[model samples]
Target: MRVLVAEDEQDLADLVATGLRRHAMAVDVVYDGTAASERLAVHDYDVLVLDRDLPGVHGDQICQDLVGVGARTRILMLTAAASVPERVAGLGLGADDYLPKPFDYSELVARVQALGRRSQAPVPPTLRRHGIVMDTQRLQVTRDGRFLRLSLKEYAVLEVLMRADGAVVSAERLLESAWDEHTDPFTTVVRVIISRLRAKLGDPPCVHTVPGAGYVL
Candidate 1:
C-alpha cells in the first residue's frame, strides 16, 4: 500500500512514516497541507493519514478539494479532539476514517490497513500464490512452508508481484508502490531487489521478467 502522511507534527509524521515503511508500505511524509496537496495531486496514494488542523492549506480544505476532484485516496483524518462531534465532523468532511491523537501504534497500523483495503478491491490479509504464503498481519512470508527472510524493499516488491496474481506489473508501477518519493525514478534498485527476491524464493522461480514489459509471478 502507498500512503501519504500529512501531519504538521514533524516528529509524529516521521514516526508514523517509519513504522509504515517497516511494514513494507511505500509512504510519503509532509508536514504542511500544501505539500500534502502537491503529493496527493501527483501520486495515486491508497491512503492519506491527514492531520485535521494543518497550516498553509488546512486539512479540512484539502479533504474537501480531494472530494471535489473525485479522488479515490482514502482519508484518515487525525487530531487531538476525541469527541464524537469531532469525529462526525471529520467524516462529514469526506474522510473515510478518523483517529485521534495519542493513539496506540498498533491501532494506527490497523486503521491504515483497513482504510487501504477499503480504497481498493477487497483482498485477504494473507496472500497466497504459487508456493509462497504472505501473512501481511504478521509480516511473515514462506515458500513451501520454508520461511523466507526478506528486507523491507524485497518484501514490498514481492507483495506487489504476488498481489498481481500472475499479471505483469510494470517496473514503473512496482517502483511507485514499493518505494517512497525519495527514490530516484531512473534507479536500478527495483531490478536489484527483484533479482535478490528471485534468488531468495529459491528453485522453481515464480517471478518472471517480461522482456518488453515488467514482471509477473
Candidate 2:
C-alpha cells in the first residue's frame, strides 16, 4: 500500500517512512502541511499519517480539505496532545484514526494497516483467490494450507491483485495505488515485483497479464 506521512520532525518522518517501507509499503515523507497537501493532490495514497501541528497548513485543515475534495485516503492524525477532547477534535475534522506522540511503532503500523483495510471496498478481511488466502490483518498468505513466504514488495503486489479479485488492474493504477509518491512512474519496479510474486506463487496462472493493460488475479 502507498502512504503519505506528514510530520514536521525530519528524523521521525524518516524513521516512520523506513519502517513502513520495510513492511513493503511505499511511503513518501513531507515535513509540513503545504508539501503534504501538494503530495495528496498529486498522488493516490491508501493512508495519510498527518501531524496536527504543521507549517503553511495545520493537519486538521488538511484532513478537512481532503474529505471536502472527496479524496478516499484514510487519515491517521498524530499529535502531542493526548487529551480526549484533542482526539475527538481530530476525528471530527475527518481523521479516521489518531495516534498521540511517543507511540509504539508497531501500533502505528497496525493502525495504518487497519486504515488500509477499511479503505478497501467492503471486502472481507480474508481475501481468497485461486487457493491463495491472504489475511489482511495478520499479513499472512497461505496456499492450500501451506504457508507462502513473500518479501514485503511481493506481498504488497499480491495484496493489491487479490483485492481486485477478477478485475483487471492496469500497471499505472498499480503504480499509483501500491507505490510511494516519490517512486518514478517510468520505472519497471511494478513489473519486477510482479515477476517475483509470480515466481514465488508457483505460476498457477492466477495473475494474468493483460497484454496492453496490466494484470489480474
Which predicted model would earn the best TM-score?
Answer: 1
The residue-by-residue lDDT of candidate 1 on 1-217, one tens digit each, is 8999999999999999999988889999999989998999899999999999999899999999999999889999878977999899999999998989889999999999888888877779899999899998888999999999999889989988888888999999998888888999999998999999999999998899899899999
Q: What TM-score goes with each of the models?
A: 0.97, 0.93
Q: What is the lDDT of residue 117 in candidate 2?
A: 70
Distance (Å) between predicted and true CA of 16, model 2? 1.4
Query: What lDDT score is found at residue 153 in candidate 2?
Result: 73
lDDT of each: 0.92, 0.88
Tell me how candidate 1 scores on lDDT. 0.92
For candidate 2, the lDDT comes to 0.88
Q: Candidate 2 has what TM-score? A: 0.93
Clashing pairs in 1: none
